[model samples]
Target: MTTINDIAKLANVSRSTVSRHLNKNGYVSQEAQERIDKVIQETSYLPSQSAKSLRTKKTGVIGVILPKISTETASRVVDGINQMLQENDYQMLLTQTSLDKDKEIAFIKLLQSRNVDGVILLGTNTDEALVNEIQKADVPVVVLGQNMPSTTSISYPDYNATVEMITYMLENGYRDISFIGVPEDDPAVGILRKKAYIDTLKKYNLPILEERMAFGDFSIESGYDAMQTIMMHSSQPNAVFVVTDNMAVGAMQYLKENHYSIPKDIGMATTGVSRLSKYIEPVLTTIDFQNEDAGIAITRLLMEKLNGYNKTKKLTHTYRRLSGNSL
Candidate 1:
């Protein structure tokens, strides 16, 4: 491997001159620039980013901590983050927690130890331990999903969006709409969304049936089981509101397997529109949270904080309802 010192010697220039030419931070003569460029092109020399980070205190890298990497939502968000980061001459060091809260906290410290310029957490819960880690992190930490205590965060319109979807179902003559959701640890999707279902039903003076609700772990299998459980109950709902994309797909699968036709036998609506939603049978009426746009916005917030903006930012990303034949 050709080092900067070798490039300097080959170009017959001082190491400081080579450094200036590489960083463009200081003045180097035009003639010297040409010589350095020629030698760099000939040798294919790559500068050590670690050395540059030491001088500037920036790794030119951001740490992205995700809950799960195998989902459509995570892919879209990563695409958006990578797009904006590349534009700003930075890249991400990615890590997945697989929904493990402790891993989220551990990765923050590990990324900090590596001196990442900032961290973007796709949070599942706002646990106190996680909040404390963010608060004490040496680099700025910006959360993308859940609102954490005293930290910059961008949250989804979980409650409002769910209410709108349920209301739309109600307007379409879905009187006995059931709910499939996750645990309350995720205050956004689990708690607020479930609350929205109950409130919307109550607003129309409809009963919130105990057997009409089922909880999933945000998985397609869990969604299938939830749908099965609700369907097997004494009373069956004409419509069901699901929170996440994976669970929604599972519910749709169960309904189809059991010979239930969407919107005729049972209707469905959900959050986080999947990429394949349009092609799926009956399509999927879901909330388009614009995950990629949210990802870009989340990254920009961390970049702003890195650029010395200090105020804690609390933002709710915009959402729009995507009408599908399922509802």
Candidate 2:
């Protein structure tokens, strides 16, 4: 219930002195700062953000737009962002698209309208219209997952992760590998990942057959269906590589039902499902993109921009391969 005014009166300082000390907008004497700090500690006073925003034109809130809230990857990233934001006394305003591309753009505009300090987008694709909208927003925007040209982004090494994962499978005698990926529109999980798979096969002189390729949405059901289709191929792949661990779980579910022994019958490896993959029997081999670390890095970039520090256009994080029994 204590106000800045009460703090100022108790500290025996003018309101402007207290404002200067709290806002860092102007100078306050060291003597005045000591008194204000003492009073604040004793009173446990919190400033009115609305009143502060009126003076500084800042909401102290960062808008986060996610492709979907249900996914573990998205949730982990948001958790990291929240960790950083809270440390800096900034709040997050979250918007979920439920994997709808149109909503991604719409939420960007909505966040701008709400006068957020900045935006952190858990991007899926780099649509031109979406890019233009971000540029026009006149606020700092940092994207996670997808890497788009002419924009700031925090991204995983998708291509490398895929290559390493596929290569590991190949090294373990998996020549004919089936891939379950999202549509090509998703640059990170789709285009980059699939490209790595195809390129890796070519490197090893393995034929990239049409039957082994299956595309699906970011869902368990889609992965299940993709695996079913792959099974129908007369010459099915000896091993399967999925873009995400969530899909891998679905594929494994199908394999379990059909009595297919993992690694012995069909090896399975995936990317970015570290949390879920460990609990499943015969643990899943996956590339750890460090989603939480990616989230933390993106928030750091946003904070750099917000604080008038050096704005990094794009930042990349390394990926590590986790060995499991499934591969």
Candidate 3:
């Protein structure tokens, strides 16, 4: 019910002075600011976001496009984003694509139409069309998880982390380590992770066998099916390195159903050091990508762009290896 006009009259100042005090733009005398603050506190007055946006061309909100909202990675990253955004008086508008690449493209346009100040994409693949759209969009966009050459991104050290993990496996005497991974369409988890797995094996003079690799869709059932296919080979693997913790759990589930004892009959390791990985049976040896830190970094980078410091930035985050009984 209280408007800026009412506040100006009550504070004994011109409406323009009240505007400067409310918007924190231009200059207001210290005494006038004090009187306006007192009147605002007494009236519990709130500024209209629409009016502020009209004046500043910013909605005071950020749009986030997630591949899937149900995963531990998504939750942790969102928590970190919220922590930073709240401190800056910004709100978040979240949308889930359920891992649909087409939906990912659609949501970018949708968020832009909604007048979001910026967008943070929890990316999957770097499709050319998507990249071109990002290049042309009026709003600044930051990609997470996957790298795009000309865009601002906060990506994990997927290649190095996988190499480190595979090296650790080899050092522990896992010679015939089969990989359960998703398709190469997802450059971060699929292509890069698999490339590291193979390169590390070759570095140690290990055989590159076709039967030892299986592809999945980053699902538990897919992991189970991949494990089944891998087991059909005459020379079964002694260890398995899965691209994701979710898939690793799926593989473990299959191993259990077939009466295979973990670390005794077979060893396992995965990325994403999810909470469930620590609590699962036999525990999972995994890589902690520090997903929350990636979230915070992306938010800050987008904020910088919104503040007119526009340039392409690519930041690679670090990871930690979690020791567990599974390996």
Candidate 4:
């Protein structure tokens, strides 16, 4: 129940001085700052953002959700999102889910109470619970990964991109191809990517063997484990298509440790044209989803929906092949 006026009175400063200090707009003398700081600590006073939002009926803040910011792909997406938000004079608040679908739902429900203008999810999964939350949210929510059947989503060309990458590997004479993927529960990188791999092989009249496929948890360690699992099979593959760059790196590490050289021993490729690719030996053949552009496009969609563009849209973002020695 403490208010700015109470803080001003207790700190022996005018309301304007308190406002200046709280907003960090105008300068407050060091002496005045000390007084305000002391009063704020003593009272545990916080700014009433709800009041400002009530006055203007808007918050110049957009909430962004990501799976992992540490990854280069996510970082590029954020760079694009920040660029667009700054151009539009809006601020951004970001949080990561670390690929936890439950946390995605939790944040969607939590964002509703936090007064965000809108939300943009760098999504990884499309659970029904998540779809329901997105549907019921007061503010417009745009997803930028999985093409949620009922939501305004900008999806990567997962199926097409995977098919292209696999075809490229085949064109290079890699008939015995293996796949490293995530769990099928995630429709985008997990199911669609794997489906593309199998379908492409079938189109080429290649056998889809169970021993040549393995799944990962989107971690480098899991990638290594999956690679190990595939290599251990008696009928080993000459090439592997990994669903993510982080997993690709893990697979690469396993290859090196096990004295299996890349491309020479087993060629490899993956989606997510990440920075890690540049430093890795023989680089990597990856499907470039142009994530920064994807971010910009998705943010523009959110801005449009915020301004009253009605019918929900599902868009497939573009991608291309990046050649490297790995393939």
User: What's each prediction's clash count?
Assistant: 0, 0, 0, 0
- lDDT of candidate 4 vs native? 0.90
Give lDDT for model 1.
Answer: 0.91
RMSD of each: 2.3, 1.4, 1.5, 7.3
Q: Write the per-residue lDDT of candidate 4 for residues 200-293, one digit (tens) a residue.
A: 9999999999999999988889999999999998999899999999899999999999998888989999998788778989898898899899
Q: Model 1 misses residue 305 by how many Å?
A: 1.9
**lDDT digits (tens) for residues 119-208 of candidate 1:** 999998998898988998888999998977799999999999999999999999889889999989788988999999999889999998
Per-prediction TM-score, please? 0.91, 0.96, 0.95, 0.83
The worst-scoring run of ten residues by lDDT in candidate 1 lies at: 272-281
Worst 10 residues of 2 by lDDT: 309-318
Best by TM-score: 2
Q: What local lDDT score does residue 208 receive in model 1, on the 0 to 100 scale?
A: 81
lDDT tens string, model 2, 199-244? 9999999898988988789888898999999999899778999999
Judging by TM-score, tell me the better candidate of 1 and 3. Answer: 3
Which of 1 and 4 is the better model by lDDT? 1
Clashes of 3: 0
TM-score of candidate 1 to 2 decimals: 0.91
